[model samples]
Target: MKIKVLGCSAGIGDSRRTSCCLLDADILLDVGTGAGELSLEGLIGINHVFLTHAHLDHAGLLPLVADAAGRFRDRPVIVHALAETVAALRECMFNWRLWPDYAALPSLERPFLRYEAVEVGATLSLGGRKITPLPARHAVPAVGYWIDSGQASLALSGDTTLCEEFWDALSRIENLKYLLIETAFLNADAALAAVAGHMTADLLAAGLSRLRRPVEVYVTHLEPGWEDRIMAEIGAACAGFDVRRLRQGMEFEF
Candidate 1:
């Protein structure tokens, strides 16, 4: 399986975009602003979207994606997320006030979008790939995804702070090769990071220290303007691990 980083920044700016990843071509890990980078044809080809949470930086482009691709597709795009996240989208995002309710758009029987509630520990299989929702502690109900392509696996710590259950889940993935974790702030903003349910460099290192196995760590979601400083702090704190900053357009095949 191939994983492509469409966007990995915490916030958008000149060349930076928010979280969004394309797993191969048919599945999206999170449909944030980076989704806008896709061509119209590429957007129309996406059959499934796995959302981490209801936050704008993680799920902002979903409505627009539905609106842009709905007319060209024969079937609705399947959206997989937590029950609370789904509820939040329905109540806040697709309420018709903020955006049209794509789940009911076009027609009820033949709509533009579909919702599937996923719980922590539940795994969904698509073709030969397995996507499992992992534990996450965020400002809202959230989850990370464990993408297993049989030969290897990757764990994404979607917008979360310190959570023992997340490490417990990661420990069980014996073939895990890549860890795309988020460190959204520098040490200077540690207090804000805590309040926002995001990790600072120090917090990330402390969490990584719990892992029993070594994996290629990629730090994602670095807030704009602080990327360099945050990465330097991560390097200093997580000295033993092979960690690097994730960049847009980066691809991994496993």
Candidate 2:
């Protein structure tokens, strides 16, 4: 599978964009602002979107995607998310007031968007790819994804704080090859990080210590301006494993 980082910043500024990753060509990991980086052709090619949470940074571009690609596609865009997250999107985001309700637009019988509620442990097979929703602790209902291309597996920890359930779920993956986790703040902002349901470099280092197996780890969602500091702190604290910063447009084949 080809995994591409559409955006990996904690917040948007300058060239930085919020979380969004494209798996191969048809599947979107999260439809964040980073999704804007894609061309209209690329957006039209996305058949499925797996959202990690209801946060704007993670799901901001959903409405835009539907609006832009609805007329071009023959079918509705399948959006897979937790039931609570789906509810939040319907109530807060696509409720006509905030944005057009694409799920019911054109016609209820043939809307441009479709929603599928998935449980934490539910595994979905799309073609030959296997996608499993993993547990996450965030401000709102959230989940990460475990994607297996049958050859190798990649684990993504969507926006989260320190949660043992996440680690427990990740430890059981047998063919785990790449782990894309988030460290949104520097250690100096540890208190704020905890309150915002994000991890600091120190927190990430401690979390990494709980892992039973060594895997290629990539740090993501670093807040703008503090990327260098957070990465330096991560390097200093997490000396046991090789952890690199995730960059936009970076691709991984596994």
lDDT (0 to 1) per candidate: 0.93, 0.91
Candidate 2 local lDDT, 212-239, one digit each (tens): 7778999999988989999999999999
Question: Between which residue pairs do clashes occur in model 1?
Answer: none
| RMSD from true fold, candidate 1 | 0.7
Q: Which one wins on TM-score? A: 1
Reference-based TM-score, model 1: 0.99
Candidate 2 residue 17 Cα shift, in angstroms, is: 1.4
Report the C-alpha lDDT of model 1 over 31-105, residue by residue, as the tens digit.
999999999999999999999999999999999998889999999999999999999999999999999888998
True-structure lDDT of candidate 1 = 0.93
Error of 1 at 88 (Å): 0.5
Candidate 1, superposed: residue stretches over 4 Å from native: none
